[model samples]
Structures are given as structure tokens and as C-alpha cells.
Target: MKFKSNILILVLLAVFIVCSVQSVSAANSHNFTTDDNFDTKFADVVNGDTFTFKAGSYNLTSDYLINKKVNLVAENEVIINSGDYRFNFASESNGSSVKGFVFLGDSNNPKATTPIATTGPTEDITINNNTFKYVYDGVSFGRYATNNFEFTNNIIDGFLRDALNLGGGSGHGDVYIVNNIIKNNLSAKDGIAIAYKGSGNLTINNNTISNVIEAISINSFNAPDLNATVIIKNNIFDNVETVIEDPNHSEIIDSYNVFNNSGESSLTHTPKEPANIIINSTISKSSISKDGSVNYTVKITNSGNRTADNITLTITLPNSLKYVKTISKTTGDYKNNEWTITALDAGSSATLSLTLNAKSTGKQTIKSSSSYLNGNETTPKEGQTTTILSVNKLSTKITVVVAKSAILGSTSKFKITVKDKNGKVLANKNIKVKVNSKIYTGKTNSNGIATVNAKISNKGKYNVKISFAGTSDYSASSKSVQHKVTASDLKIAGVKRIGKNYIVKVKNIGDISSKSTKVAISFKTDNKPGVIQYATVKVKALKPGKTVSVLVKFYINKIYSSHKRNVIIEESKTFKEASYENNIISIRK
Candidate 1:
């Protein structure tokens, strides 16, 4: 009986222990669905409790503090409209999260309080996918050493101050901000999209920010001991005055960012230094001829504040312009298109002159920049000057020849001659001939003649202008000539046998004159084992619609009964004619 009673007790104790463990596990979760105030309920929940909020709008008059290591999650779209209230996270709020909630601020209260503020040193706090709209400040973590804090995938809009201010004190470590859309903040002075004043490393990646005064501002209150490493990668900035405004003593690693503003710099930073050197550059002449050279004056002045040591001046010359020599009071070295000034003392000016020869023509821009060695504090000075160079123009003349009258719809020969001022013909020159507003371009041959064949479709007086576009060694010139175009067609009418001599009649059937024509006549014996003969005659010029006859006497074989003769008016390949099919005729007797 005692053993059995002990067994029963052990079973009851095991059941009681299991029930106790289940109750303790069930007490870690608190779910609230009503529209009641969650301030008292949140306080009643134990540390490390999972507080889940249902889908509803909760109006709060005071701040909701997530003081312990708790997870405050929303089941649906939970909107928290605050009336002079905000959400605060305490120092013990490590490993806590407040995600998937819309934080609406009270615009009536114009004070600079963040919608989500961190009160004490909080670490490993993840606030993701939360929207803060019309809030004075988006997320403010007061000067505390917070580590491993992540604020990702959040939409922060309409914040008066900073959209995300991680500045409270120094020594914050490993804050990852990724994929957030922040825009339209009203605070011009301190309204930055992501401002980091802490000392540890920050990674801001894949965020789209626009319409803010400054996109990312990194200023650590002149704290020399505080050195923060900020890595901003793959973020887009549009319409922001400055993408990054980093002061001295902060190391920023920036890459793969798309900035839409063309006028401003994508990243702007000033190094903190005790001494600075200012450089100014000026050009002697703004315009120079291609044969002339320009003088560049670079002045390096120390503003009486600090002695700049090992000052180096780099001057980048324009393309196709050779650097001649440097003319300066102080000795400097010019090598590989850069001029280096060794050093400059405080409260002094170093003036240097560079002479550059313009090798080609066009506009050339010269850029001069200065940098200081031995850990200087001031920003580098830069200046630019543009020199417009006029191309060297050579005295030239163009002579064009077109026949007094050309055959319409027939190829006309145009010869263009280009010469220098001394009447010496220029070889291999580009010549453009404009005939009645039609342009024809060709390079002159070795004889300075550019010959072109053109057919005029209409009969009229046309103006032909020949132009020589000058080279670097020559000048451009043009000359004009006039020619009347008329129609002309040449054909062979017939071949007549007049008293044992064959006469081949060639006629020009249209207007204008045909020059340098050739007529060929062939005579063949109309018998077995035929004998063939040919004769070619040249006609100097034939007038329009005029006939000219040529006689050909052929001795046929006495054994043949009759003779067959063929006459053809040959056309010149160099000259274009109207028709060639009617230029042949046959005769048999």
C-alpha cells in the first residue's frame, strides 16, 4: 500500500510539473484586440514576451515603451495614430523588434520628437517594414552606444527632421539600413535622409532617397577620437541638394550609386585639417589661333591659416595640345602632361605660368587642380579655363569649267581646279561643286583637277560654284561659273550607195552640239567565203539637228554578186549621250 501510494504521488507530481511548464510557456505571449490603451497592458507583460497586435487603429496619447527584450508584432495592418505621443525603446530593449506597424504622428505638435525614439543603449533592435508618415523625426536613437541595430525595408516619409538619425553619442556598431524609401523632409538644416554621428561602422545599401536637403550627412561633432567607417553602396539619389555631406575624420566608402542631378556632386566631403592651401588658375588668352600658343597662370596662395607642406599642382592639358614649357618664378617639374609644384609656405603665393602650343584647331579646356601632402586638412582647389582656337585659313582659289552649253539629260563634264594664292595647283584637295544648289564633292587628283559627270534634266542657265574646303595648311575659297543646258541626241540616219561609194549619214536629232564623235562603217561581201572590211572616221563637232555624211569606198571581191555594208555612229563612253540604239543603220546592194 505504501509503494502504490508513492507511485500515485509521483504520477500526480509529474502531471503537475508538466502543467506548470505549460503555463509558464503560455504566459510569454500577450494578444490584445480591443481599442483599449496598451500602456498598462504592455507594462503588465513580462520581459521576453511576444506582444501581438491585431488589425486596427490605436490612438495613443502617450509614448509606448518597449522596455524589455520583447517582440511587438502586428498581425495585420495596424495603424498607431499618436496624439503628442511616440514609441520609445529602453536600454533593456535589446533583441526586441517593432515591425509591420504604421506610425502616424500628430502634426499639431511642431516639436522635434521622433515617431520612434530609442531612450537608452539598445542593441540588436530590428525595426522593419514600418511606415512613419508626417512625423517630426522618423527614428531618433539618442547618443547611446547601440550595436547590431538594423532598420530595413521601411518607408519613412514627410519627416521634418532626419528621416533616420542614428546620432546620439558615439561607439555605435554595425547598423544595417537597407531598402528604404525616404522622401520630402522639411528640415533644411538637419533634415538628412540618413545621418550618422556615431563612431562605429554603418552599412546603408539599396535605399532610394529623394527631395531632401541632404541625402546622407556624417558629422561627428568634431570628435577626433571618433572615427566612423560608413559604407554606402547601391543607393539611388534624385533631386537632393547633396548626396553625401561628410565632414572631416570620417572614412566613407561609396560606390554603385545612381545620382540624377547633373549639376551637383554625388558625394561631397571636407577633410578636417589645421592648414589648407588655395589654388587659383587663369589663362592669358581665351582665344588663340591654331598656329599660336596660350599661356596658363596658376597661383597657389596660403590663406594665412596654416603652412601647406609638399603642395603638388597638377595641370591636365586638352587633347592634341602639346605642353611647351613652364614659366614660373619658382622651379617646377612638368612631366607627362602634369605640372607639380613642390611646396608652398603659409601667407605666400606661388605663381606659375605654362605655355601650351595648339597642335590642332577647335575649343580646348585646360583644368588645373592642387593637392597638399603630409596630411593636410583643407579641400583640394581646382580651376578651369577654356581657349577657343581658330583654324589656320590659307588663301586659295577654285576654277571651274563647264562647256558654254551642255546637252540636257546628257552627261556634262565639270572640271574643278584648286590653286593657292601664288597660282600653284593644290594636289589631293577636297573640292565641292554646287550646281544650282546640288552639291558634288570629290578630291582633286595629282593635276589639281576634280572631274565630275552630271546630267541636267531641265534646260536652263545654271550657276556652278566650286569650293575648296581648306586644310590646316590652306584657306577655303570658292568661284562661280555659268552654263546653259540644251537637249541633244545623235543618230545615224541611213547609208546610201552613190555611184559605187557608200555614204553614211550621221545626224544630231536634238538641240545642243555633239563634240568629238566617231562614225564606223563596215562593208562585207555577200558571197561564200565572205570578205569583211571596216572604216572609222572622226567628226570634230556636229551641230544640233544637223546631218553630216561620210563616204566609204570598198573594193568587193570580184567573184561576189553583192555587198552588205553596216554603218554605226559610235558613242563616247566618257561623254553621256541621249540614245545609242538609233546610232546604227544597215545597207545592202
Candidate 2:
């Protein structure tokens, strides 16, 4: 894009000099002009020259136009940076258009920011297989470039607003933009990446694009209705947004895509449709709300190109509302039809109704839901809908009661009873334990209550856990409560088998107080049929060394009636040094 139009005037005169990059295909040519001016080394040669571009930067503001059809390749690593700050290349009016060059431009242009525009109608100006870095505009197919070209496999990374633009005339230009990366930069004034305007066959396919203001636009807005049939398929518009608007040309056929669109205004789509949306069944409205003695009905219709069968409609209402359904069938029957909403289709409006009342007072909110089925359970097309009711003012009541106690014993039953507007138990409702695990477990009863039962096994100090969870929603209770269990609270209850089949006991035990210590009890003679002792009982006050006669019966015949077997009995106490005894008399027959 370096031809200034007027340069042909100077070259026409004998005084003008010409330089060409024709024989660039020769191997390993690092033939840099050792002279400050590279005029001698890079001048005049023509078509079919292959050259390689080495790894480095290039800055060219000089006017260098390809006047012949030549192949200028970027060798293993060739760089063209820093030159006469002007248009780098221009095609001779009718000479061959320059094709094939890996031109790496690093032009530090602070003023001229517009991408170099190709002038006039240039044909077969193929720009492919090159990596452009930090240039004014990577490459521009300027106004009216009717070139059947291939802009493929080029990585343009720079600071121009638009990495590429293909703006053509009405029903005129045909260009194929394929497989190129135009990213890593920004432009102030509509740096459109690719603006297609010509009325030509343009196929932009299979490439990655990112971070550009106007990434890809098929701008038929400026052109007459004679717009070009553009095919933009298989490309990623990652992190891009813009004015890509042609409501008329937005029908895209998509298949196998991972496309993410963040732009609110415009979007890009391919010409052929890959997937279409099929509505299983369509309803007149999404949802509705109603109050006292309300009736509403909608017609279910099939809105797809294909026929829908056996559509079922179900409605949900607030538990407060006692509803009556009057459908011809619980499961709807359908004929293969384009559209059919029974209520609206019935010449007049058919209706569905509900009879309702406020269960509680002072603003009640109830939600009813509904679902539609394909009528077949296994492959049913289903969706849910909900309606709500609001009561301005009403009367409501709740009752919480504790069940009557069974005679005061070691275990106390605490029942959490609840009643609705009416005093009736709604049994077997789930409740949570608001108290700590060490203290309580929210229990459920057959008669709709959360019963928290506590066993008092200690004496003296008492602590309480009040469980407040109830059985059901109507129960009106939280899963929280206060409880008091103490040493003096646990009944002095436990059994000791003094004689066979005789479980004798101690009395008057209460909530927990002092720590307990156990005194060992062992019978001097081992008895057959081993006896199992299940834990020791805590006794706060007991005679220390008194001969307490505890009856002993045996499974064996009671023999040796006089031989006194040493009977050992140990006692336990809290807050006292425990004393034991070997002085126990065996009462034998």
C-alpha cells in the first residue's frame, strides 16, 4: 500500500530509480546491504523469486510497489524493519500484482495510523503465509479490490484499530478471507477488523479472532439491497462485540460450535442453519396469578414445523386453594397440527377454576404450580408453572402443646404439639433438633408431634435443653428449645441382682452434681453360669461399712450351708473417699 499514485510520474521519467525483491528464493542469503542505504542490494528483479523472512522486526515507510508477478518468501528468518517512512509497496497500473511475501512490518507510525489501503482494482493480489507485527494496518484490501484472493495463514499482531477490512461495492467484490489471526491491538475510529460491503462472493472461514472493536461486519447497510451473498463460517469471535447488523441477513445455520457472545448489540452467524429450535408444546402464556373463586385457562398449541402429540397440561395452586379440574381428559389427546389452543380454539373461551380461602390472617401468600406432559410417562415433554394468591386481611391461629405426662419416672417425655387454624394434630411431621447432640434429639410421634424424651441418670446439678422443632409447616414451631437436666433430676434408678431373678434397687437419685467413684464388688467363690454386671449405680449417700444383707440365690443347688464364702461388696460415692469390705456373709441353705 506504499504507492502514492504520483510515484508513477517519477518512475516514468529516466531520473527515477527502481528496486525489486525478485530473486529472494536463493538459499541462506543474509545479503544485507552493508551500506547504510539498502538501495543496491534490494532493487529490480521479477516474478517467481522465493525468499525467506528471518526472525526480527521491520519498519518500512518507503514506497516499494510490486510491478511484477513474483513470489517474495520470508526465509528461515528475514526481517524488513526501519526504512523510508512512506507507502511500502504499490502495484504498477497494469503490471502484475505482487503475490506471496512474508512481510513483517514494525513501522512506528505515530501519525499515519490508517492501514495501508490497496488502490484501484487489483486482481490476484494474494497475501498469504506471513506474520505481520506492529504495523500501521497489517493489510488492507482497500475500496474496490475485486481480486479473487486468498488471505490465509497470517498472524497480524499490532496496534491498529482494525486488523483487516474488506469493504466492497454493491454486488461487486468477491474475496475469500480464510485462516488468519488478527488480534493484539486497538483502534480509535472504527478500527473494523473485517468490514464486508461489496456485492461479491465472500467466504470468510476457519480462523481465530479476538479483542477487536469491529471484528467481522457484513456491512450491507451502506450498500443497496443488492448485497453480496457472504458466507462466514467456522470462525471464533472470542471477546468481540460490534455493529454487525443486517437483521435481514441474520439467519445462520450452525453445527458443532463453542461460540460465546458477550456483545449486547450485534452478533455474527453463518449463512446456512445448523440447528433449529423445536418447541415440544407451546402455551398461550408463561404464568398467571389469581385470588378468591378465580378461573383462568390457556390453549396449548404446537408451534413447530412438525406435529406434536398427546400434550398434557397440569396446574398447581396454593395449598389454601381447594381447586377443581374440569379437563375433558386428565391426559390431553392431540392431532398432528401446527397450532391448537383449546380454550381459544373453542370459538369462545373455555375455563379452569379454583375455590379458595385464606387459611391464616393478615396477608397470606400461596403459590400453586402446574406441569405439562407429552402424555407418555417415559418420554414426556414437561414444564412447570406456578400461580400465587394474596389475602389482604384474615384471621389465623396456631396452638403448641406438650403431651400429658405418664407418671414422673427416670425418663420424661416432652412432646412438641402443634395445630393449624383449627386445633388438630397433623401427625408424623419431620422436625430438626435445635439443641446440642449431647442434650437432645428432636423426636417425632405418631400423633403429629416432635417428642423430645430425656433420661435423668445423674444427681445434684441440672441443665436444661428445650427443643422447639415441630412436625409440620402448619405446626408453627422452630427447631430450637430450652432443656434442664441436673444431677438431682435423674431418678435414683438402677438394678442390682442380689438373688437369682431378684433385681433389688436403690432410691432417690436426681440431676448430675459431683463426679462419681466406683467401689468394686466381688464374690469370693466363682459361680457357674457366669453373671453379667451391666454398669455400677451411683449412690450419693450410703452407710460406709454397715453389713447390708443383700439376698443371693443360685442356679446351682445351695450346698455347704455353714461354710461362709467370703462375700465381697464394694460401695461407690461422690465427693468422698470410697471405702470397701471383705466382710460379707453368704446366706446359704
The digit string of per-residue lDDT tens for model 2 on 1-589 reads 3676568666665343333344244433333321333343346444443333334444554655554444445434555552324323344422233233344444565224433345555556566766656665666555554556567877777646556655455335457788888775545565666766666677777777777666666654455344556666667766666524454473333322235553654343433322111222222222222223434343333332233343334443345544343333222332321112222221122223223433432233332222322221234444443443444321123233433222223465666654434445555555443323356566446665666666544322233434334321332344333344333111212235554322323322222232332222332233432442222222344332222222334445422222322222333322322112221223332
Q: Write model 1 residue lDDT over 69-123, tens digit each, in one string.
A: 8887888899888657777888877888888998887665535446678888778
- The C-alpha lDDT values of all candidates are 0.73, 0.43
lDDT of 2 at 380: 42
What TM-score should be assigned to candidate 2? Answer: 0.36
What local lDDT score does residue 171 receive in model 2, on the 0 to 100 scale?
A: 32
Where does model 1 exceed 4 Å of error? Answer: 1-107, 110-113, 119-144, 147-275, 289-292, 327-329, 359-362, 373-430, 434-441, 445-449, 452-464, 468-477, 481-589
Error of 1 at 586 (Å): 28
Could you estimate the TM-score for every candidate?
0.42, 0.36
Worst lDDT window (10 residues) for model 2?
337-346
As for candidate 1, its clashing pairs are: 142-168, 143-168, 143-169, 273-377, 394-474, 394-475
